[model samples]
Target: MNGTDTRSELEDYLRRVRVALADLPADELAEVMEDVEPNVLEAFEETGSIEELTKRLGTPEAYAEELRTAGGYPPAPSAPTRTVGDRFSARYVVWVTGFSIVVGFFTGTVGGGRYASDRYVVLMLCAPILALALWLLFSGRVRRVDIESLREYQAARRTGRSAVAQLPPNVVEYLRSMQPAWWLVRVVLLGVAFIAALSVSSEAFLLIGLLIAGLVWAGFRVRQDRRVLPVVLVANAFAVGMAVALLSAVISDADSSRSPYVTADYRGSGLWFDGEPLDNIYAVDAQGRQISKFYLYDGTGRPLVSRGDSCEPSGSDLTNEYPKPEVDYTQGGCTTSTNMPVLPLPPTAPVSVSPSTSVSPSTSVPSSAPETAPGSTPPAPTTTG
Candidate 1:
């Protein structure tokens, strides 16, 4: 082959070596390539042929393996043969992971009131499944190669590297330095989540304890075993989801409590008395005669407008008018009553007068008896049967 063809073959060999070493850190891979390119070029020039170079240096895959060993790197992971048991074990892990995600979502959405106790039971039941998954992971039943080969895993790995590469070196270093702090933070967050879970059901204390233990174990093992990364990510995702759920629940409760009586736009403003919405207002004169129509105002003289109920066909318009028609709906149709007096007024009692005191025609007697002069004892008032 001509020199150009030999150079092409040499380039192809270097490409394969780089592909083999792609899993290495970017800086380390670059260093390895720097050392590799010079040595390969010199060897190719001396050999004068790609065939001779292959015979001397072995195939690209073998050469890369030798370099890995010399550099004290882990050997390349081999694709595991998918025997029936291995396939079953892998499927089991996948199903358990999916189950965990579903349970997490469910707990986040309905983790209160009557459902709280049930959630703890569900969590307790899930402990065995989670423990089984951990066992499989630690026992090597689920191969690391299988995880690395997943399309989502590979895509995530590439995306993470790309993102890190885009960041400034100082920023990256700062992030790396904060990793230990992050581990502690995540543990604290998980602990809080566990406490929240415990509050719902004391029965699931064991399950929560198990989960916290697993999280700590995973954190410790992640450096030695990359397989633990997915677990850590899942646990963190769950903690975040639970936090969002709790925040939403609190906001929703607050809104529900206040929404019926008041709102941001004042559209929901209504007459509320003693923590309850007042549907209607009734008015009566001093003689107990019902006043059918009247307008209400506050001490400041602003109209006391309240949201009208279904009895008023007009949309949510505020009204100060009293004695709104009481509305009731039945299967037949709706009925309304403008009944003025809902309660009966007692009979008025006659006023008593003292025989000794004579009132002038222009003088007006007070409704209540006038105070007795000085210290004189007054006669007891009589009551009609």
Candidate 2:
């Protein structure tokens, strides 16, 4: 038969099954009816008693009656397995798998993939526990189901048509080869992730791709092997995503990137990381020529700011973005970057513990030398100013 005719034939088969199964729950209907999906093309190829096939597959009342007689209504039929969340079951295995994926993403993103090709190792570790969870919540999504559930699942599958709509048989078969499709996807994502990482010089993209591939591979392996490759992958992905977000959570001195806080000035010597301006800071001209920039920091773990180096970092006449020590302020009203003596002027010299540490020091008084002062003061109507 031609394409339209073939599809028509398939739909007719499914409609017969659906009517037979109309009284069943969607889960059950989907369940007993799924069999036809795997084998409808084969049926269409033959000329035989579809009636006999339908009879043996039975009706919704018959399937429900069979299920009720087997066990009390199949107990929600275990609602197909998902990649995460409801599947977690508080298992540490899942937790660790999640942990490792994060670790791998991080390592991978930081150009660490070359360090070890052990993504599979991390995933392998996570799979068993996931498999256990799958077994506990066993349904159509898992491996090692009993003969009855398996048989019923198979039967339903055989009864359903390959395509509910007008997809070609070869196309349908190609799509049905889910494992190959998964592997292809995994490879592509990872490859793209790698290239992007190299070009953009950001580990974050690769890490993300690592995660996507890991999850895909994990799910495939877990379901196919009746094992856990995919589960670990999913967990790993989550962990890495978390790590990336946390990587930049250096608590800043303020809510905004505004100043009196930290602002980058194209001028001045670049800010120091260990007493030297960060080498990564760059400078560019109007024509975009590189000269200098500074790596400014908030003095804790926040980002290493890259303020471009300027021959004279240009800004407003009013308040310079990188102010020249508007009296050396620090967060929380600390005058010096660290606690130190601020001696008053003719020169208000800030005696500092660190160039970076800005803390306002407490007052200090010089001790009077015993009673020498007593005699001196009585004598010192002459001076003591």
Residue 59 miss distance in model 2 (angstroms): 4.4
lDDT of 2 by residue, 1-385 (tens): 4554555555666555454333345445555555545554455455344455446545433544554556454433334333544333433333443455555455434332333334434434444555565454334332222221344434634555334335666676576668566556545545544554455534344444645655666665453232345344554454443334334433342345565334333323244433344323233333333323322233342333223323233621322123222223335542322111232232123223332422111111112111122212222122222
- Measured against the true structure, the TM-scores of the candidates, in listed sequence, are 0.53, 0.25
* Every candidate's lDDT: 0.63, 0.41
Error of 1 at 221 (Å): 2.8
- At residue 219, candidate 2 shows an lDDT of 60
Residue 256 displacement (Å), model 2: 16
Q: What is the lDDT of residue 281 in candidate 1?
A: 72
Best candidate according to lDDT: 1
Worst 10 residues of 2 by lDDT: 360-369
**How far is 320's C-alpha from truth in model 2 (Å)?**
13
